[model samples]
Target: MNIAPRYLGRGSWLARRDPRVLIVGLALFVFSVIQVWDLRILVGLALVAAVYYRSARIPFHSVRLQWAYIVFFVSFIVLANTILTGGDLRDVKSQALHVYFRMPLLNTPLSAESTSYAMAQYLRFLSMAAVGFPIAFAVAPGDIGPAFARLGVPDKFAYALDLTFRFIPSLAADMRATIDAQRIRGYEWEKKGRGPIGKLTRTVPLLVPVTVNAIVGAEDTIDAMDLRAFGTGRRSWLRELAMDRTDRLVLAGFGLLLLAVTAASLTGLTRLWVPPFLLPA
Candidate 1:
């Protein structure tokens, strides 16, 4: 019953099918999700990632594990930002609306446009999160590192990124072990009392072990890199990754998207944003 999904399908172990395509696909996915405050683009990007996730064969369950967390986090952010803030970048006194805003007159009336922009921006965050759900699950850290490295990302930064990816599984395993150890010692986290202080007591010990383990893992990684002569010179990729027609197509699609976003931002297209009818008119 080992139905676990791997990162790459129908490709070499290192995903050598097409580094260019993977690089562009990943970049497009990230850049597009972040660049806009529009729901249409956000939904479009999420659908695109869903397709990519299926193609990549990354486990859907792995991603769904955090669905509740994502929902809670995004919902909280959107609600807080929208309700507490106001104003758009186009406003004469344009203030960057965030969760908390500083006002010269705390009692001054908030503008409708500011409130709308705040809500829109928060929706923007939710949209990006929705889009990124798959990437968090489907893209294996090991599989994408070399492709990113070859795509002109600085070698040191690439290595750091690779190592950062590697930490996920390590952190997960460490958390499980720590939780089990705590449970065996008669500490019941869920059954713990309410309030922030009780929550802190329950989580503090769990985090300490995870942190210590992370440090130990980092040390091991440093030692291994030193043995391999890391940073001594330009190191060759373990395997030669190439570009396929599909990869080219996807990347080109992103180039087109980049152009579109550039045009929209430059031509004041985004200035036409309007809040949905459910919002204040």
Candidate 2:
């Protein structure tokens, strides 16, 4: 529900850098992490992400809502994958959290291997998410259009992409405002906890207002754009961007990092790694 615009007042180093470089670097980092399973590589990626997050100077609480869902997702992955892994069942079990449940429809032996693998997968995703913080916290939605255009994307597509990013925060803010207004009017979901159906019904009051507001906002935006002769001619950004020496240096570093990650992956260094304590004997 923390829907305040993320990039309005941020003045961090990453926030001041060229959006094109940031976009490309983050894209590369995310791509590399998706194919990797090695703990060392995952940890390293996480460290790099942490450096950026710290440098961005954005409050951690602002992004905590997203990470909260990520934690739930990772937990579900660990529990589900741990039980569903196939092969010769060794009657193995995880030594870390020694909790075992037996159900009629579910009967698969758990092991430290599955647990470790799941943790690795979770870390891989977490690190990728961390690397994405700058996009959400520092990069203004308006900059995306110019950055993509500079990267050779078509003007129309770049404009659409920029609008998509800008709308996300706007929608979130609208939803939060609707919820707050409903709460003030004495609407309570917790008091009517009659299961999923009740929850759905309760949300109606919040959803209807948000949807109407979104439609109204979209129409206004379209009318304004049309009035301004948008998309009728060559679309140029208000401020032209040129890559400075710092931008060049940062881009070069990202290129080197990409090459190193690719080399490591090809050399079999990106294989799954289970911590010794978590590895089944």
Candidate 3:
């Protein structure tokens, strides 16, 4: 609900860097995190993620909203995998909050080892998500649009990216308004039922009016841009980005950190898929 335009977000480190480097560096960080999952490697990644959000001027509250779904999704997968694990059923049970379960038609005892493996995989995913999301968060759509086009991203694709940035905030804002309107009409999200369907039932109604309003807003935006001859020619950027010395320094440091992670991971200095310490029987 705390939606605002992409480029208009508060200042941060990545935002201040030239869009070209921001784009390229983001790609590098993502690739590295996906391929490498050493705790040591992720130690640096965590720093990069933190620095990116800090530099981009993104508010902590805004960053939290942007990342809540990812955290929730990863946590959910971990829980499911933990319960269904064939080897260890209780690997992460203590850490996990109770989420209602749906009974399968077939009866089978999940193994602890399988569950442990699944939990490890889930943890790996979470590590990567924790590292990569902030970079994604810092990437402003306006910068991405032109930067991609310059890098040979098709104009159509670039436009799609641009539109994605434009839509996120506008849509979020619209939904917030919808919720407020519904609240006035005696709707309360907390009062909704507990099941997954309950969530869908409660949320789906808010979207109907929000979606319509979004469409109307989009039409108005298009009309306004058309009046201003928005795409009649070259796309000029509102944020003037030029790579500076600080950008070079930060990038070089991250590059070294990435190399260290790769080395540590391959050499067995950091292990990501290892289960947490368990008490001996």
Candidate 4:
């Protein structure tokens, strides 16, 4: 099970850009999205995110599982918001809301404002995911630490970030190998024994070996690092990242976007915009 997001070998425009540029650009985009609740503005940002994602040329198949996870997470958040505070009309200027329907058991009224808020939340999260998933696919693994280092992160911390990125995939590969090994021994992982306890009991066989192996791997890595005198002195990265004219331009663009978003948000131009049709006359 290759569950880890592998870098697509395809040379898309985003993939060609410096890793630092992508990192800063994504940060700025996410911050901008966070500053606004206006559905219209969110829609525009979502379109921008869509274009940014499409530029990577990542195939649907490559990130299908990721998309599934994102959809599940966003749906859960939206549903929860609808149920918990669906009746709150605080944001409605007239303090009057048009109730669409009441939730079955909770009797919570799902009002127009709540519905609009849910849509805005949906677009907000989806837009973030759109820009985020591409980084795992587009940036080369080796460049992550160097990019962080070039962006003023301490040497050890930068390498730790790089290791963290690589570790998740390593752990996934280990889990896959452990599952296959257990399967050869006639372990039926899918067998739900009785209830929640049974489900957890079944996971023991898979988790124990993976956990032990992970601990041992960590120990080995620590020993190797110690032998090499890592963190004892200044570190020199094998790959030195340099920003070109295009990278600088891209970074400047994202900076400008952040400034514009901040200005809009501070000026109260990015408030929640309930559709005129949904307003009570």
**Highest-scoring model, lDDT:** 4
Put down candidate 3 lDDT per residue, 59-150, tens digits, no spaces: 65656655687778877876675545422343235334222232365333343334444445554565555444544555566576777776
Residue-level lDDT for 27 in candidate 3: 60
The per-prediction tally of clashing pairs is 3, 0, 17, 0
Over 4 Å off in model 3, which ranges?
Answer: 4-14, 37-72, 88-144, 183-205, 224-234, 238-240, 248-281
TM-score-sorted candidate list, best first? 4, 2, 1, 3
**What lDDT would each prediction earn against the true structure?**
0.59, 0.75, 0.60, 0.86
Against the correct fold, how does model 4 do in TM-score? 0.91
Cα-based TM-score, every candidate = 0.66, 0.79, 0.60, 0.91
Per-residue error (Å), model 4, residue 197:
2.4
Better of 1 and 4 by TM-score: 4
Worst 10 residues of 1 by lDDT: 1-10
User: How far out, in Å, is residue 35 in model 4?
Assistant: 1.4
Instruction: State in Å the error of residue 259, model 2.
Output: 2.7
Q: Which 10-residue window of candidate 3 scores lowest in summed lDDT?
A: 94-103
